[model samples]
Structures are given as structure tokens and as C-alpha cells.
Target: MKTATKINTRLVVFAKAPQAGKAKTRLIPALGAAGAATLARHMLGRTLDIALSAAVGPVELCMSPTPDDAAWLGIAIDSAVQLSDQGQGDLGQRMACAVQRVTQLEPVLLIGTDCPGLTPALLQQAAEQLGAHDVVMLPASDGGYVLLGLKSPCPEIFSAMPWSTAAVAEISLQRMKALGLRVWVGPMQHDIDEPADLDHLPPELMNL
Candidate 1:
């Protein structure tokens, strides 16, 4: 049997507690509030499982609203991973915080729970790419990115910029270029967010 090879790169997953009305709310129109929440729960669990199974490095679950908040009650996390709160900020701020902190210790891969295509192999590939490139970014079909791998913090890329818009990935790319950083960006992948994105969900999650 092949054994798992541990890499030095750290993997950080930013997620929100699967609370109804808050989690995966964009899908509520198609799946209903309770159903959307259920899907969110499944996504978070599967994302964590994939991250751990990758064995690329130590895994961290960075929670929004913090784990102590009532929103996280009854959620069971794997003991193999570390937990931290994505303290105060908008999306860009929260992500930058985690990236800056972890990259300070070691190379890191920053991801979220919304992408079904974030398989173990993809993560390992990203980590490998980081060996030669200063950064690796996997862009989302929605124009944002699903994963970002970095050996060090790039505050300019995350500060005072528009987020959630179609320009996110492009702007970040430009920032990296201006900084003279070597970057490797993968082809676009689907991020299951809005109701229209429901079509992109994996076969197993379709029933949900």
C-alpha cells in the first residue's frame, strides 16, 4: 500500500458554521433555507475531509463567527486539524489575516468550502507548483479564485480592493505582476454559490 506523504505546506480552510439563513444563503431560493443549510453542512465536512486526506500539510479550519458562537453548536470537527477564528473583517481582510499569519511560519494553501473541484490531487499540485513559483492561484468560474498558494504574505493584493466582483482575480493578478512575483494560475473552476451554480454541484451533492 502507498503511504501518505506529508508536505511542509500548511492548508487553511475558511468556512462559516452551517447555520440556516446564513450558510449558503444564495441557494435558498432553489433549495429552501433548511435545505441550503444542509448542503452547506455537507460541503464543509467534505471540504475538511478532502483537505486532511490530501496530507499536504497540517490543516487549519478558520471559522467565521468563531467556533464558540451558537452558530457552530453541534458541529463536530476532526481532531487531526487545528481551529481558529477568522476574527473581524470583510472577506478580503479575513483571508489576508490567515494568509499573513500562516505564511509567516511556512508555505500555505488558502481555500474555502465552496469549490467541489478542490480534490486532494489539485491541492498537492498547487503545493508542488509553489516549489517553483512564488504564488499559485486557482481561479473560480465566477471570476474569483478558489485556492491561493503562497510562500509569503502579499498585503498589496488583499488591501483596499473590490471583492466579490468579477475583477477580483484580475486585480490580484495585476498586483502580483507589479510586485514582480512569479505566479502560476490554474484554469477556471466552478464555485457553487448562486442558484444558477446549482447545476455545477457534484453528482452526490445533487440530491441534497
Candidate 2:
């Protein structure tokens, strides 16, 4: 079978509505419920900005609780960025669905809104790496991953895994290896998920 060349790439941002007591719940102890949700909103906007700045290709915001949720209202998302509902499932299942749906059009680089270290340049590098490798991953300091890019569909990488755990990246990589996929590991980045991780957050966001 002939493999399709990756000519165009899309950045899929998986985010949840910034609802208090539900968004950024891990940080609630240190920042309070409202504060955590406020920070979540900030991170979401920052992530969107990074994706748009990369300008590699179309950017899609895969939202949870549906796009019509009140939490998404008043946010100034660019008209060019498409918004889609993340259908029901666990984290792994939702991600697998997104990758399969978006890759039908072109290659997709999936990311989340929790990682402040995800920059436009880093996204561009991942896109470039995907042109040659079967997969590209940006590892998080917490042992999870901040970004994953694929030139083709690979659902096995996102199935039956422990979500929100330190073993996420390791398990995912092992799955990729078992499937004989070439993977490019990117720089180690940290995501804001706990009180300890607050130190890594931007000063402006820290105030929230």
C-alpha cells in the first residue's frame, strides 16, 4: 500500500468549557474554584493564540460539553478557526475520534490547553517533523505529553490508556513502538495541572 504524503497539516486543540468547579479542578485548592476557572479561560485563549500564530494550516478547537455551552460565549475566537464538538467518550476515546475525523482531510497535530510551554515555534517544529516521521510527540515534565502529531491514522495510540497519569507518555510511546511507528520526541514541557505546577504558570496567569 502506498502512504499518503503529508502536504497539509491541521492543529486540533482539545479544550473544555471553563466552568468553575469543573475546569482546572486540580488547581482549585491553591487558586480557589473561581480562580482556577479564570486561569483555565486564560490558558485556553493563550493556546488558541499560539495555534493561530503558527499559521501552518487550519486550526480546529475541539470543545467539550458542546460548543453552544455558555462557557464558550464572549471568547474572541478567529472566524477562520473551526469549532467542533468533542463527542462522548473517555479522554482516549475522544482523542481517537478527533484524530480519525480530522485526518480524513489532512495530517493533524493534537494538543491540549493546559500546557503554557506550547509555543508557535514549537508547533511549527512539530509540523515539520511530521513530514518525515510517522508520529511527533512533545513530552511533558509530568510524564504526560503536551502535543501529538500524526501523518496518518493511528487509533491504537489512544486506546485503553490511563488518562491524567504520569505514565501516559510512556504507555503511548510503547504502543507506537509495538505498532512499528517511527516517533520523533520533542523537548520536555510542563503543564499546569496541580498546585505545585503553579510555579510554571505565567505571572499574569498566576494573579488570576
Candidate 3:
């Protein structure tokens, strides 16, 4: 009997330290500094849980403000999971760097901690699609992307683009087309960012 070969697909979670005033600042007006940070912490935990449950492959937590920050002490991550700094630069530079580093080991699916709708099945679906597509994007309802997976490093897709605007997904697809990279897009999902987005939060996190 022959054993089936496993694909080397990594789930890279891009997260910020859930510190008051530093995390989820956009929602602070509605939830206060502490409350917003609490929500950030909850979202990060949920994201991590979903990634682990997906069991697609190894998981990495790419932290902003570094992994040594005290804000990480509140969450319990499996010691087996890899931890690394998000490195210097804007969102584009940071993601490009992270993707470059991880793609050396295996293809990577990069995601943020903001989307509560991200599930294990969705992560698995993205990973599975990467086996055929050059890139896979899970578009967000807010015009950004909730997830991005790449079979290989393509820095052009991440460079010189506006980060927080509605044009993000549109511009990204344009760049991918310019590079002649094939893209697979998943269903749209929502992220918890502004006060209006609070209604989408899970019931347990709605107390805020």
C-alpha cells in the first residue's frame, strides 16, 4: 500500500497586538478603548481557532508590534504554531515580506483577524483551490479582502496600492491580471471594523 502525499499549505494569520488604544481604534467611539481591544482579542482568538480547526497545514501568527509585546500574553496559542514579527512597512510591504518568507516552505494563505465569518471550511476551500490557481482571494463585503492565498510569491500584487479603501479588491485583481496570474475568488464576507459593523458580531461578543 502506498501513502498519499500531503500538500504543504500554510495558513498565515496577520494580527496586531490587542492593546487598548492600539487595536480596533475605528470602533472605539462605540465601544471605548478597552471594549474595542476586548473585541479585537476575541476576534483574534476566533480566527486562530478557525485556522487550527481547518487543519490544512502548519499555521503561523505574524504579529505586528512583535510577538514579544505583552498584549500577546492574554491569548493562548499552541506552542507548535510558528510565531514571527510582521516586519517593518505599510500593510502591503508587510504582507509581501510575510508571503515571501513563508512561500519558501510552502504555499501560504494569508488572513487577518477581523472577519468573524471566516470558517474552517472556508479556509480549507481556499487551500484546496490553491492547488489549481495561482492566487485565491476571499473578498470582503467592505470592498477589501478577508483572505489571500498564493502558490508562489508575486510581490506585484501587493505593491503600491491603497490599503483601507474600497478600491483594494478591484486594484488587486487588476494587478493580478497585469501579471497574468490566474485568480480564484471565494464568496464575499464581512469584517468587524466600524460601529455599523458591530451588528455582525457573534452573540457572545455582542455584549459590548
Candidate 4:
């Protein structure tokens, strides 16, 4: 029997507590604040399940707003990193912190809860690809990334980029290319950030 070679990669899932008035705030207009909050909780729960089931190595939950809030969610992970909205500055800062923390132990793959499209197979591919590349980014159709894995902690890629726009992935790709960094691009995934994004999700996800 051939034994599977374990990849020394840290799988980090970034999340936030599904608190009313705080979680899924963008969907409030269409799904009321209370409804949006409920959906956010459901979505996050599902995301955590997927991560826990597929993880091949140490997993980290990088919770925003507060990590303590995620304690009651009952999601099992190797570690949890609390993030303060402070000094986050923007999405870049938060992402950088996640990578830095995990890269201290091993290669890190950081993903968010928005991508219901993420699967265990894809994550494994990313980890394997990292063996030959400096970075691996799974671009989203909306111009962001669903997953980003790195062999080394590179803050430049995450900082000073225009976030929450279609150019995010494009700009990051350009930066990586310019720096002569060997990058691997994975299959694109859809992120559930806006109302239109809801259409791309499974029926059960939208109902939740």
C-alpha cells in the first residue's frame, strides 16, 4: 500500500461570528438584517464543516470582529487566531496577518467563508501546487480569489491593493508576475458577497 505523503501546509479559514446587525451586513436590504444574520450563520456553519472534513493538516480559524465569538459555533480546528478590527486597515492587512501567523509553522493556505465552491480536492491541489510555486491563488469570477496559498509569507501581495473590486485578482496577478514570483492559478470559484452572487449558489445555500 502506498502511503499518502502529507503536505506541510496550514489550512486557514477566515470567519466572523454570525451576529445580527454585524454579519452579512451587505445582504440586509434584500434579506432584512435579522434574516441576513441567520443566513450568514448557516453559511459559515457549512463552510466550517467543509474545512474540517477536508483538512489534511493543521487548520486555523482566523476570526474577525472577534475570535472568541466563534467559540460557541462548535467548529473544530487546530487553532484559532483572533483579529481586531483595529490595525486591519483593510482586507490586505487582515490577510497578511493570517499568512504571517500560520507561515511561522508551515506553508499557509488562507481562504474565506464566502466561497461555497471550495472543495477538499481543490484545496489538496493547491497544497500540492505550492511545492513548486511561491504562491497559489484561486481566482473568483468577481475578480477576487477564493483561495490563496503561499510557501513563504509575502506581505507585498496582500498590501496596497484595491480590494472589493473586480480588479483585485487582476492586480494581484500583475504584481506577482512583475516580481517574478512563480504563481499557480487554480480553477475559479464564485463568492457569495452580493445579491447576484446568490444566484450562483446551490438552492439550499440561498434558502439558508
The reply for model 2, stretches above 4 Å from the true place, is 1-7
lDDT of 1 by residue, 1-208 (tens): 3333334899999999898998998889999999999999999999999999988899999998887888888887899989999999888888788888998789999999999988998998888888778889999988899999888888888898888888999999999999999888876889989999988889999996
In candidate 3, which residue pairs get closer than 3 Å at backbone N, Cα or C atoms, i.e. clash? none
Residue 98's lDDT in candidate 3: 88
> Judged by lDDT against the true structure, how good is candidate 2?
0.89
- Please give, for residues 1-208, the per-residue lDDT of candidate 2 as tens digits: 3332445689999999988999999989998998999999999989998999998899999998898888788776778889999999899899889889888888899999999988898998888888888899999999999999987778899888988888999999999999999888999999999999988987767675
- Could you tell me the C-alpha RMSD of candidate 3 in Å? 3.4
User: What's the TM for model 4?
Assistant: 0.86
Per-candidate count of clashing residue pairs (backbone under 3 Å):
0, 0, 0, 0
TM-score winner, 3 or 4: 3
Collision pairs in model 2: none
| Clash pairs, model 4 backbone | none
Across residues 1-208, which tens digit of lDDT does each residue of candidate 3 receive?
A: 3222235689999999888999999999999999999999888888888899999998899998889887687677877678999999999999999889888879999999999899998998888888778899999998999999997788898899889999999999999998888788999999999999988888877884
